[model samples]
Target: MLIPKLLWPLLEYEISTSSVESIEAIINTFTRKWLGFPPCQRDVAMYCRKAKLRLPLISIVEEYKCRKARLMTMLEDSDETAVRLFQSHLTINRKWKVCKAVEQEKKALK
Candidate 1:
C-alpha cells in the first residue's frame, strides 16, 4: 500500500531508480511508516509480495546486473583496491542473483 505510493513517485522522478540501496530505503520507509517498528523486518517479504501483486517492477534486478557489469569493468581496468572491491561486489552480486532467481520462479507461478 504505502510502498507503491512512495516508490512510484521516486521512480517517476529519478531517471534510474534501480539501485538496491535505493529500493531498500524506499521499502524500509514504507514499511516503517505504515506498519511501524514492530515486525518491520518480518513484513519486508510480504510488502514485496504485495508490490508484485499490484504494480510489478523489475528495475532493482536490472540495476544489480548493471552494477555487476560495471564492477567487472572496474576490476579489469585496475589493480589492488579496485580488485578487492570487485571481489566484494561479486559476493553481493551472487546474493542478488539468488534473489532474482527466486523472483523469477515466483513470477512463473503467477
Candidate 2:
C-alpha cells in the first residue's frame, strides 16, 4: 500500500546499511501501527477486523485481486503476445507475491 511505498526508500537504505535490527524495528513499528497489533501477537480474526476498519468501503484489495486475476488470465491466453509486449516489463509473478504478502499481513493482524 501507500505506507509501504512511502517506506520503500527507507527500507532500501536500511538494506544498504545491512542493519538487520533497524530493518526489523521498522517492520515491527509499521506492523504495530498499521495492523493494530504487534507482529508476535497477530491472528487472522484481528487482521480481518483491522482490514475491514482500515480499508474503504469500496475495498482496493478486492479490486487488486480482480485485476490481477484478469491480467494473469490474459497473459496465459496470449503468452506470445504478452512476451512480445512486455519483454522485460512483465512482473506478474512479483505482483502475485506482493498480493499474497498483503493478504498474509491482513490475516496476521492483532
Candidate 3:
C-alpha cells in the first residue's frame, strides 16, 4: 500500500549515494514526526518490523537498493548491446554507487 503510493516511479533512474542518503534523512524525519517520536529518536522504532510495536515505516535506502539491484540484474542480462554497455559504465569504473551497494549486500548475504 505504502510503496506504490509513495515510491511508484523511483526505479525509473539510478540515483547517487548522496541523493539516496539525503532522501533517507528526510524519510527518517517524516517517519519520526508521523510516529510521534522525538527528534533524537533512533530509527529502529520506525523500521523494526520484528518489534512488539511496529511502525509502518520504510527505509528509502533499502527500497532504492532493492530497485537498483533489480535494475542492475535486468541490465546485466539484457539482450540489447546499448543497455549492457551503459550498465558497464566503463569510464566510471564499471561500478556505480548502487552497484557497489548491491555487491556489498550480496557479500553480506553470503
Candidate 4:
C-alpha cells in the first residue's frame, strides 16, 4: 500500500538518489518486518535474490534513471521547437544528483 505511493513520485518527479535511498529503506524495513527477515541481513538481499531468480525485480534507482532518460529524449525530440532544458533554482542549498552520489560512492570505495 505505502510502497505504491512512494514509488509513484520516482516516475513523476526528479528526486535525489539519497531520497530514493530513503524510500528504499522505508520499503525494505516494511518488507523485512512482513517477511520475518533477520535484522542483520541486508534488505537488498531479498531484492537481489528475486532479481537473480529472474522474477524481474528492478530497483527504484534503475527505474528513475530510465524514466529520466526517456523523458529527456521525449523533450528533446518533441514537436515543440522551443523546448529547452529546465534550469534549476539558486535558492536550494544542496542539489543531490545521481552522478554526484555515484562519484562519492566511488571515492568511498577508494
TM-score of each: 0.27, 0.28, 0.70, 0.59
lDDT of 4 by residue, 1-110 (tens): 55456567765665666777777777678777887878897756765743554323456666665555555555556676665343122112144443344446558989
Best by lDDT: 3
Please, what is the whole-model Cα lDDT of each candidate in the order they appear? 0.49, 0.44, 0.69, 0.58
Model 2 vs. true fold: TM: 0.28
Clashes of 4: 0
Q: Residue 69 lDDT in model 2?
A: 40
Ranked candidates (lDDT, high to low): 3, 4, 1, 2
For model 2, how does the per-residue alpha-carbon lDDT over 1-110 read when each residue is reduced to its tens digit? 65445344532231222243345456546656785765575433333645655533222233344444444445545749745464223343432443354446558874
Alpha carbon RMSD to native, model 1: 10.8
Tens-place lDDT per residue, model 1, 36-62, is 556535434543645544324333435
Poorest lDDT segment (10 consecutive residues) of candidate 4: 84-93
Error of 1 at 39 (Å): 22
lDDT string, candidate 3, 16-95, tens digits: 64676677788778767876899878887778899998766678767866776777767878999999877655223233
Model 1 weakest lDDT span, ten residues long: 9-18
Alpha-carbon shift of residue 8 in model 1 (angstroms): 19
Q: Which stretches of candidate 3 lie over 4 Å from their true place?
A: 1-10, 89-96, 101-110
lDDT, model 3, position 6: 49
TM-score of 1: 0.27
